[model samples]
Target: MPAERMADFRPDAAADVTDVVCPVTFVKALAALDELEDGRILEIRLNDGEAARNVPLSLKDEGHQVLRLTDNGDGTCALLVRKVSACPVE
Candidate 1:
């Protein structure tokens, strides 16, 4: 897939959250999710196995949504996610 399509990344969109290019900090990123306003979409870059899998899973578990991901061959991948409106706004 093309990087743009796979990444599902749109830098022009409104951003409420972002993180260092780390997978382990995904939980930390989740914790900071509330800081995002409802209906906001955030883009992230992740590298390595644990994060590529965990971040998406964690977002789902928290009731947030993983809109899409670009699987870069290297450890780095791009993610597009939206915060759930139903979750309490932080």
Candidate 2:
């Protein structure tokens, strides 16, 4: 079987870019999640590349946890990160 890759996530799923149009960075994604009112299970569907790979680590660094990682098998992956707790105020 082929190894699961993060880069594949991007092309497989089209970024909505609808409600939010900020730079599609991992940090931006986190910030968006932080600003959300509802506790979210954010499914960051991106190509299995830098953004996809770094998101989990970035979340961990910020005290958030990645709850699930789903590969769509079509060049996209879903990173389901629950808003478990707050990122400690700095």
Candidate 3:
């Protein structure tokens, strides 16, 4: 999505994992998403390079909807993700 559209998104929760490293970054982000109700959005602030590369893909693999990822221009990035409802078992 465009940056303008991304600016309009109001996340239900936010997490900053810039202080942490790779797997931990994604872990923190996942924990934040877990606290939110399904369909709610989460804004994750993480460092560039590894965290930026891995977090969003990890979220997507877990069935969340990745809305946007934008650079903050300060060696950090913001990732917007929406928690998706789990499919019911038949």
* Top TM-score hit: 3
After superposition, the stretches of candidate 1 with alpha carbons farther than 4 Å from their true spots are 1-24, 85-90
TM-score of each: 0.63, 0.60, 0.88
Task: Report the Cα lDDT for candidate 2.
Answer: 0.56
Best-fitting candidate, measured by lDDT?
3
Ten-residue segment with the worst summed lDDT in candidate 3?
A: 1-10
**Candidate 1 residue lDDT tens string, 1-90:** 465565544442432223454444575556556578766776766765777777788787777777887766766776777778564559
lDDT (Cα, tens digit) per residue for candidate 2, span 10-86: 32112221233223566566665765544455666666656557767777676665666767787667676656566
lDDT of 3 by residue, 1-90 (tens): 666777788899999999999899999998898899999999999999999999999999888999999999999999999999667657
Per-model root-mean-square deviation over C-alphas: 5.4, 7.8, 2.2
Ranking by lDDT, best first?
A: 3, 1, 2
User: How well does candidate 2 score on lDDT at residue 14?
Assistant: 23
85: Cα error in model 2, Å: 4.2
Relative to the true structure, how large is the alpha-carbon lDDT of every model?
A: 0.64, 0.56, 0.92
- Mark the 10 consecutive residues where model 1 has the least summed lDDT: 9-18
Q: Which portions of model 3 miss their true places by more than 4 Å?
A: 1-6, 87-90
